[model samples]
Target: MSLLEVSDLRTYFYTEGGIVQAVDGVDFSVNAGETLGIVGESGAGKSVTVRSLLGLIDPPGTVVDGTITFDGQDLHSLTESELRREIRGSEISFVFQDPMSALNPVYTVGSQIAEVVEHHTDRTATEAWDRAVELLDDVGIPDAAVRADQYPHEFSGGMRQRVLIAMALSCNPKLIIADEPTTALDVTIQAQILDLFEEIQDRYNTGLIYVTHDLGVVREVCDRVAVMYLGEVVERGRYEDLFNDPKHPYTQMLMRSVVTPDRPVSSLDPIEGAMPSAVDPPSGCRFRTRCPVAIDDCSTIEPPDYAVTSDHAAACLLYDDDFAGDPPVLHERTTGGGRDE
Candidate 1:
């Protein structure tokens, strides 16, 4: 069985205006020692989906339906206290995007990590401190022992990220959810952090859920890719399959926008139209409003995930065999001209 399986998960916020369906009917899985990247635009519900998995959604927001099974244990069945005591930190951990806000300015880095270790494991305070230093060293932090005593401000952006990673590793959790962990760092530093994540995953044999809008970052780290739109997973498959042969129009647009080394800056074609608001998302397929290949049925009937291959699936009317018309071709705009696919 997979290490984590999320089925038709739905998380909605009861706002004064209306219900904002942040995560509506999402499904995915992560295997042991595998990295699954959830990629999408800002309002695609990538972060909210991961937060829902950990039962971290606050007041007004509720996980109204679906099952999140981790190692055969349904996470939704556990109470807040039960999740905190048994599941969170010990069984699964989270690494947030911004290290500056994640780490407390008042506390030394080592103490922060040690606190989690002490709370989640049988290690004594002293033993936890030692483990914290070891974790810092493992994540490639220099002068680990001395740096451990320093405050969050004392470390650089990359170092602070490493510290957060160390804290995530404190309890030796089976799964780690890193939500855009490299977003705030420089390109060079981002590469280092991504490398560290891969190393940690390999060394610990832990399942990893990497949430990021950067498809480039996903290409470097993730084994499988799930592309979310508005609040649903529109497509999912092996990274190579999804990257090389995107079956969904949104995914194709995302690929066309990627700044590859060979592709000039002028070749980038941004997708038109903003994402529909979650409060009242577009009916039928949420992406139909912006989909280049959207058909008449796409505006009225939601397309179920259709199999593009045994392992690849996409939710689009274009993939339906019963559709008689020719599929709309996407044109990649270039500097001099447009290339039709």
Candidate 2:
């Protein structure tokens, strides 16, 4: 069984204008020691899904429907204090995008990491301090003994991220939710951080939810991937399967935009059109407005998820049986005229 399961979770914000669906009817599960990558354009609700899982969404934003169960316990049903005591940073830890902001300006890195260990575990202060240094070393921070005494402002962006990772690992949590953990780092630092994550997961046998807009990072670190669009999971499968045979138009367009060394720069095809606002997303398929192959029905009725293989599923009309005639051949349609009526 999976360690965490999110089913049809809807997180929305009630603004004066209308309800903004941040995370709409999303579903996925992460097995023990598995790394699940969530990839999409900005405003796709990747971060919202993770935030909602931890009950971190503010008052204006509410988890409207569905269940977020961690290890068979319903997270949405847990009491506020109970959740804080038992779940957050105890069973699950989050390493946010901005490490500089995540750490306190005045507290020593060792004090922060030590506090996490002391809070979650039955360890003495001296023992926790020793463990904190070990975690610093584990995350590849140099001079761990002395550096642990330094403040957040004393470290570089990459080092601060590493410190946050160390703090996250202090609890020995079952799951780690890393939200663009290497966002501000250079390529070399990005590689090193990713390597550290892999090593830690291997060492601890913990599940991971890696949320990012970077396709290259997803391909590199994730065992499986779920592509999100406008709060829904548009496509999901093994990393290799989705990358090799992407069925969703949105996923295909994203792949086209990626500029790899092997692919000529001229071959890169950027997907046009901007991501629609969550407050009033386009009807039917949320991606319809931006999809090059969007058909008339795509704007009227939502498509059912079609299984491409046992492990792969995509939410698109091209695979729907109810749609009349042969599935619209995308290769023949550029202006949406080749669709079967």
Candidate 3:
């Protein structure tokens, strides 16, 4: 069985204007030692979906419907206290996007990690501190002992990110949810962080749900990819399948926009228009408004996850059995790892 399975996950915000459906009917899974990359444009509900898995939604927003199963246990069924004590940090953990914000300025990085280790395990304060240093070293922080004495401000952006990772690994979690952990770092640091994730998974056999907008990063680290649109998953399959021949129009557009070292940013084909607000999104297919190949049925009939291949599925009317004719496909551009419509 998969390490994590999320089904019909719907999280909504009760706003004065209207109910903002931040995460609506989302479903995906990841196995041990596997990496699942959730990729999409901003406002595609990638972060919200992962947060909902750990019951992290705050007031004015809540999970209205869904079952988040981690390691065969229903996370939704666990109470807040239960989740804090039993699930989070012990079985599952998160490496948030902004490390500086996630860490407390008052506490040293090692103390912060040690606190989590103590909270989740039966280790003594001294033992937890020692484990913290070991974790920092494990995550590639040099001179771990000296670094352990430093505060969050003393660390660089990359080092702070590594500290967050070390904290996540403190209890040896079965799954790690990294919400764009490398988004704020430079290319060199981003590559290093990606490599760290790969190395951690290889050594620990940990499952990972990596959320990001960069398909290039997805290509480098993800074993499977889920393409989210608005609050729904538009496409999901092996990374190669989605990049080489994207079945969904949204996925095709995304693949075509991949920025590589060879492909200059000026030559990138940008997708038109911005994502619609989650509060009262368009009826039928959520992506229909932006889909170039949208048909009349796309306006009235909400497309389901149609079978695309043995291991691939796309929520597009074009992939439905009732649809006629073949759909357009992506071709690898001359620029390595780039796709063209």
Candidate 4:
């Protein structure tokens, strides 16, 4: 069974300007021990989607529709307080983008981690502190016992991230939601963090949802991927498949824009234009205005998820038989990892 399943999830913010449809009709699931990457440009609603799963959206924003099911239980039915007391740390945990901000400077690293442990489990104060040190050790922190007593500022960026990871694992959550966890670190540190994530997942068999816009990170870590555009998933498939044979034009453009070993920087095709405002996104297919191959009907009709394979699909009309005059030739992912016409 899937560890977490989100269907038709919609989260909107009530503002004087208009309702910002941050996450509109999004659907994806993560199975136990599997890693799913949600990739998109800024404003694609990746963070909001994950936040909604944990009932973390506060005032001015709310989950308007759909269900969030984790471990076969409907999370939407729980009250915010109930979610915090029961689910947030025990069954699911979050590793936010900025570790420095997430940590409280006034508290020692061990105290912060121990606080979470004490809240979720029946461990005593002394035991919780012990567990915090052990967790820090588990996440590769050197001299974890000594580091645990140090304040957040004492640790470097990468070390602080490790502390956050340790805290996330404190309660042995079934799933972990990491939002751009390594975005701020140097490339070497980023690589190490990615390796650490894979290592931790393997050790615990924990389901993972990694939210990132980095194609390189997606390629390295994700088993399956969902490509978001203007608040909707435009394409999804196995990482290698999506990376090479991107079915949706948006996905294709994203692939073309990234730097690869074979594709030189000059030859790379950067996607044009910024993402449209979510409050007033384009009609019908949200990506139509930016899609290079958009047809006339694309403006009038929103395409459904067209199956390219049993496990791969794209929400683009170009893949549908009636929409395209001729049966469109599906792009093949060449063995060399280049976009072959």
Q: Give the lDDT of residue 133 in candidate 1.
A: 97
Evaluate model 4: give its lDDT.
Answer: 0.89
After superposition, the stretches of candidate 1 with alpha carbons farther than 4 Å from their true spots are: 331-341
Residue pairs with backbone atoms closer than 3 Å in model 4 (clashes)? none
Candidate 2 matches the true fold with a TM-score of 0.94
Local distance difference test, each candidate: 0.91, 0.87, 0.90, 0.89
TM-score result, candidate 4? 0.95
Off by over 4 Å in 4: 326-335, 338-341
What lDDT is reached at residue 14 by model 2?
90
> Which residue ranges in model 2 land beyond 4 Å of their true spot?
264-266, 324-341
Candidate 2 lDDT over 278-302, as tens digits, reads: 9988999899988877778999988
lDDT score, candidate 4, position 238: 84
TM-score of each: 0.95, 0.94, 0.96, 0.95
Show the colliding residue pairs in model 1. none
Error at 65, model 3, angstroms: 1.1
Clashes of 2: 0
For each candidate, C-alpha RMSD in Å? 3.4, 5.2, 2.3, 2.5
Order of candidates by lDDT, top first? Answer: 1, 3, 4, 2
